[model samples]
Target chain A: MGFGGRCFRVQWGPSALRRFRRSGCRTVRLSTVRDSTPGQRRVPRPVDDGDVPSVVALSEGRRHNGRVANQSGGVTHMTLTAVGVDRPGIVAALAAVLEDLGCNLEDSTMSILRGHFAVLLIVAVPDTIGAETVEAALAPAAHRLDLTVAVRPLGELPSLTSNDQTGRSRTVGGAGADLGEGEVYVFSVHGADRPGIVERATRSLLEAGGNILDLSTRLVGPPDAPVYVLHLTVGFPPGSDAAGAADTVRATLGEVGVQVHAEPVEIDVL
Target chain B: MPVRPVLTLPAPVLTCRARPVGSIDDEARALAVDLIDTMKVSPGCVGLAAPQIGVGLRAFVVDVTGHRKAQSCHGTFVLFDPVVDSASDLQPAREGCMSVPDLTGDVRRASQVVVSGIDPQGVRRTLHVDAFEARAVLHEIDHLDGLVFLDRVAGPHAVFPRKVYR
Candidate 1:
């Protein structure tokens, strides 16, 4: 199928000549200054000495090496992966440690795979806290659970800027390579895990004008069964018949003894 | 003309709906010029509204085409008494406001739009735009309605800390 219709070219207007001054955008509510009531003092209030104790400061402060300070909002994001022999309280123990550090768990996904419990979390903590503090504070818990842990700050949030007036709707790639005419399509293929199963499957898709948007695969079942579960997102040519693409993909994988299931994504309006 | 101080959130005038353009005469043209001059004089600004300069009039200026990604759009316009046609689907975009300093947010808006309004010369015209142009036009239209970007933020994550966006 040929890519026809409009190529979606960009358009320009007189505003093109003017320089974009980044005037910050925000709104404010009006606050009417209320006059003080008669006989009401306007002097600053002072804290009572007895109510505020200045005698002793508690807790020792330590200089953590390689601490990246997150001074923005109170929200924090952390990705943690843990693997350990089946044992109770592994999560509880680790969670307790994080809670003690004043971290709030936002969201988490956990699964038992290959006899190991893996957990990923989006977390939040008080501002001015550093990644080092979280790692150090969680180190003891990791050791106790007998699971290795890795920690890093969350990736920067994406922002849409008007500096470029070309509102070309774009989908970004994790590998930083722009996939041509990308669209999100999900695929699942089940077959015996072999050296070239994934390679052949992806190759077939690429030849049919599809780009793999996201992919994850795993060897499943016992060694005797030797089955595999492959999950991936592929971009199809805008003009390609989506059903035909799916069928072609399935047929190509079938030749290699792989079972494939593919479907177009139904994107909800934002 | 002096660079007018941008009124921030909590400024009563920001939410106060502006009056329609009575006539696109010298004073209205002067407001447009002051807006352009004031915006240029400020550090980094893309648009300005009369309400931001303490005028409650349905007039604003925007020029996003000079910025990145917006190069394909109509760069600027002195939109007066504008109305956005809602004939297209809404798309969400991250937006910042000059009045509400230090905040940015994701705002749902029409992906394409046609704006009808009187120009400084009292001539009525309709401008068609899509995507970023639609977004910029919608943003300025909000100003005419006495609305701010903060009002469009869906949630906390929808808003971001201000960066030195030139």
Candidate 2:
């Protein structure tokens, strides 16, 4: 797969699935269950009038089990997701719970979309704390705040290695090895919004043997005619023709009705 | 005079507002010489401030003679108790500091400036500087005020990690 294809996988969730379906995009529900741990399992109960008390009872039981699992030393990493209506104190409450559970927040992205607030966090917990333990601990806050919470254990990070085809070392997510040896440039494309814009631009650079270091896209302007803006940091091999590659990308994007501009990102050390 | 060790972030001396040089005594003259010597020793360094050498004195040395970016080239000079008389034509440019290594930021500084200070000979002088020379002077003045390029970054994303220096 190309660098953009591998790194820019669209996040699919229940709401996202529904939106995709409405937009006439083909999407499938990969899994309904949030947590994927084997031994301790709790199926998501359908929301109904009589099931509320039972759900609370099950959560309390899980919390009791979590107390027994609290041991010292071994560390486990997991991804935590929390979504609810926009309100103050949600982050503080979630942070308080994590702190109490002896978990460290490593990396996280939080933002408010429409009227809903979403938070995704990568946290490290002590070995004694399982995915169930984290979910159970968050139950009270989730219930009180009317939020959906899920926790799933993460696998080990993939080791970085050199790509045989390009003869250049590439890290997961397209972080090029030692930018000092390579030339870095900022590439920007802005114009009318259209499908396949991202794919086309990224494919051109990839074909030219350029690696994307970072990228972000935004759709702005009037609701009737939104403008698409794509900004990316790309790196080229030491002796590669960076200007030629950029020219090809510009011409390719220009054919698709987007204006392109590229400039070398200067870094001065004093 | 000898080349002194340049201080980085978290060094208390770099953060505190430097004290003015009351007079250019033997000690002050030696500090000026050390600043110039240290700037010469550090690769690609065009300027050095007293606070960078752990001395909280209002003094600095700048020499951008052969640098490509430099336009109003000043061979080499040292100043004590420097004050920016007037600055105009603000422009945003990427800058890194010896006192704040490993990171660079886009900071907006005046492109043209008139600065007054006492030279190494204890004589007062006013310099009309622009382009890279103005930038170097402004950067050193920031050090005297306990500020780095990080403080003047255009936005959060303006700061970037510097991979290498050669």
TM-score of each: 0.40, 0.68
lDDT of candidate 2 over A240-269, digit per residue (tens):
778988999899889978999999876554
Task: Give the alpha carbon lDDT tens digit for every residue of A1-270 in model 1.
Answer: 122221110011111111111111111111111111211222221222352222211111111122211223554666555566644555555555565665544334455555666666554555556777787888887887687776678865233232212221111111111122335467989987767778877887787777775566788789888888898777665576656777877898888788999865532111
Off by over 4 Å in 2: A1-86, A94-180, B164-166
DockQ of 1: 0.06
- What is the Cα-based lDDT of residue B50 in candidate 1? 85
lDDT of 1 at A226: 85
Candidate 2 clash total?
A: 1
**Predictions' DockQ, in order:** 0.06, 0.13
* Winning model by lDDT: 2
The iRMS of the candidates, in order, is 16.2, 14.7
lDDT tens readout by residue for model 1, B1-166:
5456665544557767889987788899988888777666554456678888788999988776555545337666787898876538787666656564434456788776888888777889788877666777777778777677765666433444333222
lDDT of each: 0.57, 0.69
